[model samples]
Target: MNLELGKILFTAAIADAVSNSKDFSAFVCQSIEKHKTCNWGDCDPEDSHQNDLSFESGGRILSVYKNPAAHEDSEPKIWIITEWDRSITTVLYPSDY
Candidate 1:
């Protein structure tokens, strides 16, 4: 899939985190690439299916990526979402939701 992500945005907290860590910056970049390619990161079957459906419906596209463990494993850090109109894509921690 060749999805075009419009202007990408992120929360201020995300900005701060990305700015402070090269590893996190790389993770964010790689996650975005996967999102645009329809990889959908670590989203479950239903969500991945929704992302696929979103292409035709122009509905919101959501991708969740597991962040490396700070305390516990399997924490979702990248809650990347592209709006229905594709006018904007946002990246943020799930806690920010």
Candidate 2:
């Protein structure tokens, strides 16, 4: 099911990147669509479980999306988090968290 994203937010660094880079901005937009539609990107099994539960349990939801060009062992490219109350959703780089 497609979920509500509530108020969307971005950290300064992410906002800057999006504003400055068209490719990255498109990726972020697509990632957000995936997130709201429950695709959950590259999140682990545990996070997948939590995301599923959050749909019914009113828990926080987390989605991790990776940059295919980045090293597999590197930190995630982005993290999208929707608050438990669904009052807000944020898109940020992991380091920005």
Candidate 3:
């Protein structure tokens, strides 16, 4: 799949994880490879929609959703949102969402 990292808005806790550890990053990539959509059942109902899915990577959860605006002629752009274990969530985009 054509995956890319866009604007990564991280929460305070997630920011620390990104800067201090590589597990979170690895999990994101793995989740994309293993599951393309949010069929894992723990997804946030509010964010999930057609072509948009959520996943649980290790102890963290992430939302891998489609970016409607980033869609090309035939290809669609996907964005990753890093959701921390806490109540903190991060929004990211490869381009403007």
Where does candidate 2 clash, by residue pair?
Answer: none
lDDT for each residue of candidate 2 in 1-97, tens digit (9 for 90 to 100): 8888899999998898789777778889999999999999999999899899998889899999986544455444899999999989999988987
By descending lDDT, how would the candidates be arranged? 2, 1, 3
User: What TM-score against the true fold does each predicted structure earn?
Assistant: 0.89, 0.90, 0.31
CA deviation > 4 Å runs, candidate 1: 69-76
Q: State the C-alpha lDDT per candidate.
A: 0.85, 0.88, 0.40
Whose TM-score is higher: candidate 2's or candidate 3's? 2
Mark the 10 consecutive residues where model 1 has the least summed lDDT. Answer: 67-76
Residue range 1-97, candidate 3, lDDT tens digits: 3223333454454345346546554544454543333342234566444224223322334455442333244223334443433234344333434
**Candidate ordering by TM-score (highest first):** 2, 1, 3
- Report how far off residue 23 is in candidate 3 (Å): 1.7
lDDT of 1 by residue, 2-23 (tens): 6778999989878988897788
